[model samples]
Target: MSIPTQPTDPAATIPAVGRINWRAARAMLISEGRLLARNPGVVLWTVVLPVAAAIILGSIPAVRRPSAGLGGLSFFQLYQPILVFFAITLLAMQALPDVLTRYREMGVLKRLRTTPVSPTLLLFAQLTLILSVAIVCMALMVVIPPLGGAPWPRNPGGFVITYLLGAWAMLGLGMVIASLFHNAKVAAGFGSFLFFVMQFFAGLWWQRPNMPVWLRDISDYTPSGAAVQGLTDSSIGHWPRALHLIVLAVWGAATSRLAIRFFSWE
Candidate 1:
């Protein structure tokens, strides 16, 4: 009878969805960066390999000779873009996926989910670290070549645009690999296989101009190939073909969506 009614707390009616914990994200990013710096394998792949390849190749007299097929640019000059793409590919296909897979396998991601920080923040942090490394590697690739007498890209803006697009495409591919594989070893093995295949198609081992017509046509649609072509075109003062940009954009968008839809956080 006329028992009682309790006052409700207005705050209780609302979900406690807080803003992103930037402090936590920043700390994780710093920790990840330090860990990455200590990993020699990552250093070799993302830094040493690309820079070494560029320097060693640039030193070759034959590579310094201008070729008609390359629009009067030497193989060394054309290879600058290839080296930049190589750095992106290494980070995306090998380092990033392996690290993410390891985190999931070791339950790091699971622990992260229980914290104030979202586990996705860790993923973003890893990507940011890897991208920072990629940028530094690419910068070295660009700056070192001129010391070897190679010309800089003719259209700096186009070159930068193409580089960014290519990096995004490759990183998206890496995210897909990270999402699909629960085992770090399996991810590393598959990532390595894909890395080598992409390198081949990107003209790391064989000149694109020397590839068979059909093979070249197919390679043009691949992320690495499109990236190389885009960079090379911009290096020579021409905007990349629409096909190159379209291929990179499609790869980036499709792979990123798939990764987001299916990503596992332990």
Candidate 2:
């Protein structure tokens, strides 16, 4: 009788190594950054509106005043986090999957097998560059608003923590999309759909404070929702709820695992 065998692991081809090639990694980063700068259209459009909106809103005295409708939270306070998450969500859901699928189709990933550099380095570089753009945008939104007289985030540490976790979860979702889809069109469509869903939960359509109690409860479990709420709390001088942080961590971990398990070079 023939012996049965287990299927090969997705990451088995890339053997474990004790060390990373930092020089190669640095070169990849520079190359990727140059490409990103060359194609600035997407980044420009995706981030400009939210950043401008945040600054405009913050500068206005009307939006800065607490409103009864938002449970005494000023409009700027409510929307700042939403805007921050919006930019990153767009990058993660659209830019990330789009680039990965294109690379796979062009055989860049497959060709890397013949090169000294690991294909994984390219993936890491893309993630770092994209996340770095999102972070820069985040910093601008936060710093500029206060200069315009809007309130600053009271718990800076909590704000930073929530943002990092949220970005991790969103980026992992992007990697998962790339790992699953072979066609660029298919990946873009799926990413676009996910982008809208994330925005809805992040309060792009409806402010989190204004959502119905039962509906808000439902949003709490989603990465976008949890992250937004946590950011809101941090902005208002409260530490993020344990539950929200836990939800973000779970989303990050689960999506990252799935991406690694299913990801392919081509």
Candidate 3:
């Protein structure tokens, strides 16, 4: 007797299992982008708050006064970098981690693993959205400073380099946090705590130039602190100090490697 063979499904054969599914990835990216656009918290943190803070600070007469310590730049001019750093911190620490952990909690990443489209594509989409928001916020920051008569960066190229490096370091740290935390609530809480501490070191609450020598020394090593210092240096026409760039590069490389190694699909 001959054995009966099961028929293969033509639909299944059309989408090869091991191939990259750009169509699926693109669809997922569009969906995630729409969700992100509708998130009130993301809008508040990444867009509205940064711009509002810059405008408010720029409006202050005292802050507009040129400071001898700031290389004759006004307090508002010096604050431009801090506001940009704040936007980066908000997205990288608070927003990115929360989203990734939520996906894990919802089993979204696990489900995606069964398809030809890798779950990593979703992560890339989210990062792209966050980076776009950050760029807009940074541009707003640069524009607002000039509105208050604050001078633009003297070394624009150096400023761009510092900004990109700082963003890479912070985003890498966020990825690490997301990879480690399974619970969305815990991830968000920890991210917020990190955000505040980094902002403190970045001099959002106090002027870096006025900080005690030891404290300033310590802050310079922190990612946010290094970013602020690098941006400030570049704003005045100097290349960021080798030390600051090194710190940022080290953090970016180390945290990114750790995140990739530890990341879980579910």
> Which one is best on TM-score?
2
What ranges in model 1 sit over 4 Å off? 1-18, 59-62, 69-72
Weakest 10 consecutive residues of candidate 3 by summed lDDT: 9-18
Q: What is the lDDT of candidate 3?
A: 0.87
lDDT of 3 by residue, 14-97 (tens): 756567677877888899988986875765656687778887887778887888986586787678789888998889998899
Q: Which stretches of candidate 3 lie over 4 Å from their true place?
A: 1-20, 59-62, 69-73
Q: lDDT tens digits, residues 1-266, model 2?
A: 98868558857656466468789899999999999999998888889988899889899999999999988998889999999999999999989999999999999999987886789999999999999999999999999989878999999999999999999999999999999998999999999999999999888888888899988998999999999999999999999999999999999999999999999997
The per-model lDDT (C-alpha) reads 0.87, 0.93, 0.87
| lDDT of each residue in 56-173, candidate 1, tens digit only | 7766778878899865778876787888898889889999898999999899999988976789988999989888888888888777777777667888888888998999999999
Clashing residue pairs in candidate 1 are none
Model 2 bad stretches (over 4 Å): 1-18
User: Of the candidates numbered 2 and 3, which has the greater TM-score value?
Assistant: 2
TM-score of each predicted structure versus truth:
0.90, 0.92, 0.88
lDDT of predicted model 2: 0.93
